[model samples]
Target: MFFLGCFATATAAAAAAEVAAPVPGYVLDNTEVREIHAASLKRDYQLYVALPDSYRASERRYPVVFVVDAGYAFPVARGIASRLHRHAGMEEAIVVGLSYAKGDEGVYSRRRDYTPSVPRNGGYRSDMPGRPAAFGEADAYGRFIATEVFPHVAAHYRADMRRKIFVGHSYGSLLGLQVLLTRPNTFEHYILGSPSLWFDRGVMFDREKAYAAAHGDMPASVFFGIGSRETLAPGKQRSRAEEDADMVADLRDFHGALAAHRYRGLATTLKVFADEDHASVFPLVLTHGLRAYLKQK
Candidate 1:
C-alpha cells in the first residue's frame, strides 16, 4: 500500500513538473512600459532594460545599446548580451529597447519616426506605406535620442557616454545610417542590420558618398549586417530578385563609400549571415558585434 502511494505521488510530481516547464525559446517577460513622444511621433514604447548580473554586485557604469524595433529584437539582444558577458569576456552593456505602442498608432508611428524621407511616389517603398505625411522623421528621431532619451537614460542608469551604441534593423537601420551621415558622432558605435536601402531611391547611400567627398576625416565604428534570406520577401509591384539585387548593390556602395573615406579614424565592418533570414539574423549580429565592439575597451 505504501509503495502504491509513493508511485502515485511520483507520477503527480512528474506531471506537475511538466506543466510548470516554460515554453521553448520563450525568453521575454513583461517588466515595464513607458511613453515618449519624440520625432513628432506619439510613441508608447515598451522598454526592456537588462542589467548585467554583476551590475548590482559591483557598482560600475557600463556602455548602453539603444535597440530600435524592440518588439522582435529585445530578447535577442538580451540573450546575446548575457552570453557575450559570460563566454566572450565582453563588458556588460545596458540594452534599451524601443517599440511601437499598440492600436492604430503603432503602424504609422514607427515608419514616420525611423525613416529619412518619403519617396516621391507617396510611398515609403522600403516598408509598406502607412501614413504618408508622417514619414521622413529620422532627423527628429536623432534629436530625441540625443536630447530627451539619452539624458533620461544617463540620469537613471549607470551608462558611459562615450561607449554607447545605437542598434537598428531595416527602417531602424535607415535611421542609424542617417544619424551617422549628418550627426557623425551622436553615438560612438552603430550596429545596423539589414537596412532598407531601397527606400526613397537609395538617397541614404548618395548622402554617404557626398559626405565622404566633403569631409576630410570621419571617426566612428559601424557594424553592418544583412541576412542572406532577406531578399526572399515577396514585393508588391516589384520583382523580389530585383529588389534584393538593388538592396545588395546599395549596401555594397554604402560600405564602399565608408571605406573610401579612408579616414584613419574611421573603422567599419560589414557581415552577411547566409543561413539566417531578416527575422532570424539579429541575435547572431548582436553577439558578434558586441564581442568586436568590446575588444576596443
Candidate 2:
C-alpha cells in the first residue's frame, strides 16, 4: 500500500509538470522584438531586430539597415537582406525595424514624426471635414533615433556604427531627407523611395537650398527611386498643371538639383522603375537600393 501511494504521487507530479510545459509557437528564426520607451517621444516603441545567421558564432560587427515604417516594411526588409546576403553576394547586415506601440494605426504618429515642416496656420485641411493636427517633429524623432535607438542597439548587439544605413519610403523618405540634410553623420548611406517632396508646397527644396548654403560638401551615398507611373493623373487626385504635387517631376527635379550641386563627396543615383506605382515600387526599390549600397566596400 505504501509503495502504491508513492507511485500515485509521482505519477500526479509528472502529469502536472507536463501540463506546465510551454508550447512553442512559430517565429522568425533570427528575429527579436524589443519593447523600448522612447524618452524623446515620451511613448513606447517596438523595435524588431533581425540578426545575421553567423552573429552568434562570430565576434565581427555588422552594418545595420534601419527601416522606417517597420509595421509593414520589416518582413520585406528582413527577407530581402537574408536573400541578398545568401545568394547575391552582398554583405550580411543586421536589419532593424522601427515599429509603433500596439493599437497605433500610425496615421497621426507617422505624420508627426516623419515630416519636417508644419503649415503656419496649423495643420493642412484634409479632404475630410475635420483637419488633423499640425505635424513637423522630425527633429525630435531624429534625436530619439540618434540618442536612444542607436545606443540601445549598440549596447545589446554588434553594430558597426560607421556603416549605418537608413531606408524609408514616402513620408518616411522625407524624414530620411531631413536627417540627411541636418545630421549627415547619423547615417552613412540613405535609400529614399518615392519621397513625398510635395509636402508643404515644395518645402524640401528650401531645405536643400539651406543645406547648400550652409555646407560645401555632403559625404554620403544616396539612392533615390520612384515609380514611372507616379506621374500626374486624374486618378492620383492631382493634375499635371500642378507641378508642386507632381511626384515624378518633383523627384526628377530633386535629383537634378543634387546632381547640379555636385557636392564634393556625395554620390547619388536615381532609378525610375517601369510600370510601377507608388505602392508597388517599394520591393524593387529596396532590392536595387540594397544592392547599390552594399556593393560598396
Candidate 3:
C-alpha cells in the first residue's frame, strides 16, 4: 500500500510539473540593451544589441549594423549573423536593433519617426492605412540617431564610427534613404529592402534631387532588394492603395536613379527574389545584404 501510495504521489507530482507554467526564455546570448532618451522628441527608446561571440576577448573595434524595426527584426538578424559567422564564412560585426519608441510602438511611432516629410489633410494615405494621423518626423529621429545614438554607442561599445551599416525595410528603409540622400556619410553601407517609394507621392524624389543638385559626389554603397510578388496581380482581389504601390517598379526606378547619377564613390546593387512578397523578403535581404557587407570586412 505504501509503495502504491508513493507511486501515485510521484505520478501526481509529474503531472503537476507538466502543467506548471514554463519558464521565460532568453534566446539571444551575448546581447545587451541600451537606453537612450531623445531630448527633442521627448521619447524613450532602447537599442537591442547583439555582440559577436569574440567581442569579449578581442580588443578590436567592430563595425556596427543598425537594423530598424527591432520589434520584428532583432531576433532574426541576431540568429542570421550568428549562423553566417559560424558556418557561412561571413565576417562578424555588432548588430544593433533600433526599436520603436517605447509606449507608442504599434501605429504611431514608426509613421512619425521614419517618414521624411509630413503630408497635408491629416497625413493619412490609402497606401499606408492604419497609420497615425500625425507623422513625418524623420528629421528629428535622424537627429536623435546622429546626436544621441551615435554618442551613446561610441561611449559604451567599441563601435567603429567610420563604418556604420544601416539596415531598414519599407518605412524603415525610407528613413535610411532619407539619411542617405541628405547625409550620405551617416552609414557607409545601406541595406534598404522594399522601400515605400509611394509614400507622400514620391516626396523622396525631391529629396534625392536636392541631394544631387547640391553634391558633386556621394560616398556610399547601397543594396536595394524587393520581391517579385509585391505588385498587385489582376485576380488577387485587392483593396485600397496598399496593393497598388507597384514596389518592384519603384525599387528598380530608385536603383536606376541612383545609378544614373554616377557619383564618385557611390555603388548600388538590386536583387529581386522570386516567389516572395514584401512580407517575406526581409530575411533574404539580410542574407544577401550581409554578404554584401563582406566588402567592408
The residue-by-residue lDDT of candidate 1 on 14-61, one tens digit each, is 999999998786445423345565534454445567777777777788
List the candidate 1 regions with Cα displacement exceeding 4 Å.
Answer: 1-34, 37-46, 101-105, 123-133, 230-245
User: Which residues of candidate 2, in runs, are more than 4 Å off?
Assistant: 1-26, 101-103, 120-134, 234-244
Better of 1 and 3 by lDDT: 3
Give lDDT tens digits, candidate 2, residues 91-207.
999999998545445776787789898844353444324556647998788889999999999999999988999999999999999998888788998999999988877788899
Ranking by TM-score: 3, 2, 1
Candidate 2: global Cα-lDDT? 0.87
Query: Which of the two candidates, 1 or 2, achieves a greater TM-score against the reference?
Result: 2
Which of the two candidates, 1 or 2, achieves a greater lDDT against the reference?
2
Each model's C-alpha lDDT? 0.75, 0.87, 0.84
Candidate 3 at 229: error in angstroms? Answer: 0.8
> What shift in Å separates residue 97 of candidate 3 from its native position after superposition?
0.8
My TM-score estimates for the predictions, one after another, are 0.79, 0.84, 0.87
- Model 2: what TM-score? 0.84
Q: How far is candidate 1 from the true structure (C-alpha RMSD, Å)?
A: 6.3
Tell me the lDDT of model 3 at 80: 86
